[model samples]
Target chain A: DVKVTQSSRYLVKRTGEKVFLECVQDMDHENMFWYRQDPGLGLRLIYFSYDVKMKEKGDIPEGYSVSREKKERFSLILESASTNQTSMYLCASSYGELREQYFGPGTRLTVT
Target chain B: AQSVTQLDSQVPVFEEAPVELRCNYSSSVSVYLFWYVQYPNQGLQLLLKYLSGSTLVKGINGFEAEFNKSQTSFHLRKPSVHISDTAEYFCAVRPGSNMLTFGGGTRLMVKP
Candidate 1:
């Protein structure tokens, strides 16, 4: 079974604080993604990395940035967290050309 | 650009009854379709996917989805649902790009 693990299941942060969400996949997948899931709105892609140090912007990438310095790790960074940034963050990875993504448990971020 | 639309926001069904969650997509080129289930406080899990050959794809937990190219729809179905089947369902479409476009999502509530 493919395993994707997130750093935290729940996190609370004050406004203007920097927040980092980490994800690690054991499957040696080449594609990793970060998404924010809101009620009714479903999941919106925040950022994705096709290869190490390579990134692409998604639909809602304004308030979020991502890093993939290593093949197995992907990190989501909130430069300065805000109340509106609170949501369920998910990390996923897929092997090259397969396009079937496996997801981590998710991190519920609460920006106060 | 590819976009997905889940026609129903929520579907309530009695235990052991049939259920269906509707999804549709709009894209200029060929696309891949997927259905994912997200339990409470958990990340999304792949239920089924339609890449090419077959139109009807079966997934775990006795769930299945049929891809209708002419209608541009991929609707999920289950002959009978259980309490454990309650969750949010998301339909996603991937065009030529590596990124995926997800639908608004449909919440399935199974009553006893």
Candidate 2:
């Protein structure tokens, strides 16, 4: 089974604080994705990496960035956290174009 | 552009009753369909996918979905549901090699 793990299960931060969410996948999948899930909007993609040091902006990428220093690790960074950024963050990985993504336990972030 | 739509925002049903979650998509290119379930406060888990071959795909925990190309829909179904089945379900579509576009999601509530 593919295993994806996140650094934190829950987090709280003040406005304007910078936040980092880490994700690691056991399998050497080439694709990694970050998404923020809201009440009515569902999971909206933030950023994705297809290779180490390569990233692409997804539908909703404002105020967020990503890093893939290693193949197994992907990180999401919020330059300046705000109350609007408070939501569930999910990380997922898959091989190439395969849609069978393996997801890590989400990180519930709260910004006050 | 590819997009996914989940018609029902929430569905409440009694335990051991049949349930169906409707999903629709629009894409100019061929697309892959997937159904994912997210337990409370957890990440999404792949319930099933339709890439090719069979139109009716059976998934874990006695859940199944059929792909209807003419209607451009992939609706998930289960013969009977339990309390454990209560969760948020998301329908996603991947057009070609692009990133997946997810639906708003359907929250299933199973009552005793």
Candidate 3:
């Protein structure tokens, strides 16, 4: 089984604060994704990386950005966190398109 | 664009009883279907996936789902549920592409 690790399990931040969420996958998958999970919204993609130094914006990428300087690591960045951004963030990786995606443990962010 | 719909927002079943969670999806092209489980305060875990070839797919925790293409549905089922099975279940559909579109999710409560 592939193991994906997130840097933090819980995070707290004040409004307008910059926050960073990190993820690492040991599977050496080619595709990485970042999503925000909410009560009714399920999981909405924020950004995704198909390869190192490559990224694409998902449906809700307004306040989120991503960085992929390394193959095993992918990071999500919040330029200015807001109360609305307080949710669980998930990271997933897959070896190829439409393959089974392995997810990280997730980070629960509380923006006050 | 792909979309998934989970019919029941919450389902309550007694321990050792059969349970079913309904899921429907819409996509123009071929898509992969998946069910994910999220435990309390934990990240989402992949329960099962339907890629191709077979209509019935088995997953972890003795869960199974059948892909009904004509009905546009992929419902999850389990003969007997345990107390530990109480959690949030999410239905997701990927349009043969990398990104996945998820349903609103259904919470399953197995009581003793």
Q: What are the lDDT scores of the predictions, listed in order?
A: 0.93, 0.94, 0.93
Candidate 1 Cα misplacement greater than 4 A, ranges: none
- Per-residue lDDT of model 1, residues B1-112, tens digit only: 7789999999999999999999999998988999999998778999999898989999999999999999999999999999999999999998865578899999999999
For model 2, the docking class works out as: medium
Q: What would the per-residue lDDT of candidate 1 be over residues A10-83, giving only the tens digit for each residue? A: 99999999999999999999999999988888889999898999999988999888889999999999999999
B1-112 per-residue lDDT for model 2 (tens digits): 9889999999999999999999999998888999999998778999999998989999999999999999999999999999999999999998878888999999999999
Candidate 2 ranges with C-alpha deviation above 4 Å = none
- lDDT tens digits, residue span A13-85, model 2: 9999999999999999999999989886788999999999999999999999899999999999999999999
Winner by lDDT:
2
lDDT value, residue A22 of candidate 3: 97
> Which is the better candidate, 2 or 3, if ranked by lDDT?
2
Per-prediction TM-score, please? Answer: 0.97, 0.97, 0.96
Tens-digit lDDT track of model 3 for A55-103: 9999999988999999999999999999999999999998978677888
The superposed Cα distance between candidate 3 and the true structure at residue B79, in angstroms, equals 1.1
